[model samples]
Target: MTTTTRGTMHPRFDEILTPEAIAFVAKLDSAFAGRRAELLQTRRDRARRISAGENLDFRSDTRHIRADASWSVAAPGPGLRDRRCELISPATRSMGVHALTSGAQVWIADLEDATAPSWENVISAQVNLYDAVRGRLDETREDGSTITAEDSPTTIVVRPRGMHLCEKHISIDSRPISASLLDFGLYFFHNAQALIDGGRGPYFYLPKIESHEEARLWNDIFVMAQEELGIRRGTIRATVLVETITAAFEMDEILYELREHAAGLNAGRWDYIFSYIRTFAHRGDEFVLPDRDHITMTTPFMRAYTQLLVSTCHQRGAYAIGGPAAANPTRQDDEHRHRALALVRAEKEREAAEGFDGSWVAHPAVVQTCQEAYATVLGDNTCQRDFRHGPITAQDLVSLEGVPQTITLGGVRTNVSVALRYLASWVEGTGAVAIENLMEDAATVEISRAQLWQWLHHGSQLAEGPTVTRALLDRVIEEEMAVLTRNAPPERARHFEQARDVLTQTALGDYLPGFFTPYAYVRYLIDRPLRMDGPLSPDDLRQSEQVATPVTNGSAA
Candidate 1:
């Protein structure tokens, strides 16, 4: 296929969408687009097999890879040893500045779930990240003064959209390109050498990988990218999130696949839970999960997952990073703030004590607590890779037999409310929202909706005696919408309606869609004519209206 560098570009996108950057992205798309499509189809087939009652076990073919004791992942790259990482959306300039100055060791300049994926947002995030990489990020304060990063800034690790999402606005050969490549290619094209010059290479956090084959794909992309940019063989490093049930079973293989480029693996708790639910949604009451609130890391199943992660990473000589602490302190209430702090402290302490090298925090407030917890366990040590805690069996990993399984009316209502609010915010171009004090993102929303689907599908009996049927869910949705409509501003109320439609379709549909973004993207995020063809023809977007308008003050008008 001939490489075409022409596509619809947002007005604000011109700065980041340079001719050279466009060509580079086109090159990546031309090279890897076929593999990406095949992987996506493989995902569909795997999901079908699981739905047909096929048990998810470690692949027999890969037994040797898992059993081999001689293999280990590459050593941690620069600035990744002590990973007290904080996730921040790069779309927000002030947030980007705050993340750099917040003193966390690593800042996840997120372009995936934490972002709204608006064309404006997509370009703006790239611009912000570009500025951030060059140490040119500055935010004007209320006093008309500027705030900038200190002498020592946090290391930036970009998390592009997963393999499943597409950048519909950007096309190659009239087909939409992978969102992952668009993000990775553009960032690498512009910032790879600059990041290397600054002593840190182009680092990434690969999200939602279901198997080692996916890891191999990423590794291959890294190799091709490095070669294209004339970078050293191992200059690029990635930390894979073992967030899927299938991935949980293939940790060792995943690391082996990316050994040359792998820094470590993350225990992505929420998405892990969502994956479990989605994988077993067809299975009867046995796999029916309890409330999302009760599914803490200390729970038996969760404990098993994290323990296996720590053990697997250590055995493979990779850093074992723990999940995100999503608590955002509520300043209006002292007790609430204290409670939130206590919760974060306990969670971090648990991760540290359980032999994780480091953990993630969603807000800056928890950074110190995470650092202090790691300090207690690590002291001067970079990681606990020497700590071996498992010869854990497949039975142990999937043993949900005796875990807590109570469902409450409150839990159902919470799921509905949270999912509605989140979808509403998401469609309005806000991927992260503070819901009841917690910084909720796509993962949390996934759990909420997945749980709702599981409960309704299984006719789960709530503690209050009502079964979680579609009728019960509809009543609850109506009740929640009424309350939101009554109290919310008019613009927000409109968003609430949009959110309701999205949540209802995704949660109550006969079959769960692989992801909510694709459906919502076409409906809410794309303003142009829906062209289902090759590279978006110039004529396709010639008179296309902007799909995503700017949100003022994060409001959804």
Candidate 2:
């Protein structure tokens, strides 16, 4: 074998990680690893410039790409014509079953924020996707029920890990490979042909892209993968996540770069907020965001962003998918459930009115609500590409003045507690957790903690009349840690401590790190072997406590 598997072996995993598959990924690593490193370094360099009083604006050099009017992306690929509702979930066996049956137009098999990059998670997610593509995901459960689709199955679109991460479990000649390449290569190599035969293309939602050149890299990768697999050039379709402020400026260039394989662009609100804070972490209070709850879609800056996304996508003949609706209907209260559904419907109503072709709902219960909202706007139509929104400018995109800075002690406490709980679950190999009727993922953790750092960095005042001090942060974290430590089982108490370690390292540091996932993954989540002979419950996360420590503090990026 040309590659190494540093993780445990099990049934069906070997099928996914065959020698050919590993070799294919190894080739991809050797080819693009240099460029990936250079681009990541470029991000760090750009961040340094932003920190040194440089503001974000449209690139002068890429003006022609935006000014040109004759270009349009390829038509919507198979199964992507009407994406009015897309269900986003991690690729666990059960979750995969539910998502495919949710009656949504698309199911984004997310390997990024919705998943933590544990060895067991990274490999087994591929197994779920493999079984799903082959239509055997639900042969028989131990409970003896067959997985049934309520209607036609949803289209599957995979979102791989960002370029900044590494797949430490599988390596080439003692060197780790890019996690992005591994996820993309394994899926495309194994299932591209099968998907095409089934009348669906190998689709993807690209995440964390910061520039047009980065989009170009993905385009070249798609081209080469198709050629290697003997598929057509434009058979692979991708939707770039316009989540970063930098990418927001270059949306035109990004779509142009991947025009042949481009599906559309999505308004990723959570990560965009995280990026906003991180981009301006070194600045004064002008950029400090209030509580995450207060920063709704109606905020001036967010409206500017969504308006720009819709116009750009329509101008380029691509679908403009909106952000998540952020409500779960599973909570057990008649009044509360009705209220949540009402809010979810209203949110989708606004998106449809603003010309979004589709929107995301985290749970199955809200699917019909989203569908109804879009149905009103797009009756018998697949998308709103014909509808056009008015124009916007660069200053409107970056101006945070209209947002009310109602920072409160409650907000600080909430950030600390939520960050603690979410990080704990993340290390336990459960990426999506339900807390307070909302499903929280890595993006939740990013914005939660980044807001803390940004507020503290500026000494912003809380509504309770005290400045956000390191002492205040330390006290709040300590209190939240005590609550978590008390509630945790004896075997799982260490996870809480580890969670606090990650929080302090990321949120309370002198310099704000670009992302906490890379550092935390390398330090704590790197090579814990799981007894994957059966489906794992939350209790099984502590299967083996013996682990080797990896170097942390932003080195993984």
Candidate 3:
């Protein structure tokens, strides 16, 4: 099958989007697209069942897989063994430099949620990695002196787009391909050998995976890509993010399926919260989450999830990575800076103290804080297989009845402000931004909007007495928009307007959308397939009026 690129091109994109690479991606897509579709349908069916009051429990069929104690995942591969602290950033040049020089043990070059997945980004990220692999990055400092990027000891991992998305820009026989395959295939095809030759490998961080079946699919791809590329079979390694509520139950099964290729699991806080809301959104108010800000790592149910991850990974002889501190101290004011770092240190200290082999930091600014905590806890930078916390029950996984319902108008306003600002940046081609000094990405937006939708759906009452209604949401949004867009130029203000439309449709519509990215990507990111031979015009950046529904149905509650 021949694959064609429909998106506008940038300089040197041809180097990454070559015919050979396209063919490789097409091959993987052809093999897996049917299974991917079936799995997506299965997700919908399972979600419907749960929404209809069916309960979630560990799969009876996969019980033996978990009960068996003889099996274990392969040990961590090169440059990944001691992941004391890793950096997560968009795969952009500037961010890449900061990540590499941040002194973290691993740099996850995020092409998934942290990236906008613009075709330019798709190509440029590959180009950047292609260069970084060969030690060819050259940049000039502010003082006008050029510095070759450090050949840092940090390992590199790439996160592909999740299964829910497709790379519409690249098509096989006029059909779009899985964004996951496009990302994984292209990166593996181009750089696997180079990485192998350098004693590193084409490592990946799988995202938003809900089942061990998905992990099996990735393992199959790893086998095929390595065979096709003529690399060793076990050369590739992947750390799965147990982000979704469903995935939290299948941690052992997921590892069992990817045992040869599985590196470990990372606790994904925001997406886990988002998934919890979406999975149980239609349930009674008992399940309605409080303000997202209140859902801390120590929250009873959340602690249960993380404890399961740590116990599961250590039991299988794999690394158990923790969530990021995500505090960019550089963005904090002086008074707030000390407080932020203190909070960051405390958070990292808890993760390390809990026997997490390592953790993540969003910005380079907090890498040392993470390292300091881990270094003090894990002097040798390795974990014993003695994770003492476990035996977490299904009720523990699904328990949210105990959390206090502290919904407030302030929480509502915060969600609106965050969703609008983050969506604006995402549609404008950036995926990661610092909001109030914390790293705000697609996952954060998901948590914020999903909580908003859940509160409004359940008619949850705020501490200030009024119930959540469309009128209340609209009023808060209007007040927040004025603050967000004040002193902005026309184009800038219009961007914020488009962002409001996105938030309205995703958060206030009759039902909550599965994700805001796909919603906004179709309405805002897609443009006519015109060549980018010149500068982008106003027509290029504007949202598509064809699908512009503002979702203005009001409620009187």
Best by lDDT: 2
> Clashing residue pairs, candidate 1?
173-534, 173-535, 174-534, 174-535, 175-534, 175-535
Ranked by lDDT, top first: 2, 3, 1
Models 1 onward score TM values of 0.93, 0.93, 0.94
Candidate 2's residue-wise lDDT over 135-239, tens digit each? Answer: 877645788878844334689999999887777777666566788899999999899998999899999999999998889888888887888788999999999
* Cα deviation of 4, candidate 2, in Å: 2.1
Candidate 2 is scored at a TM of: 0.93
Better of 2 and 3 by TM-score: 3
The lDDT of each candidate is: 0.81, 0.85, 0.84
- Listed per model in order, the count of residue pairs whose N, CA or C atoms clash below 3 Å is 6, 0, 0
Weakest lDDT window of 10 consecutive positions for candidate 2:
548-557
The model with the greatest TM-score is 3
lDDT, model 2: 0.85
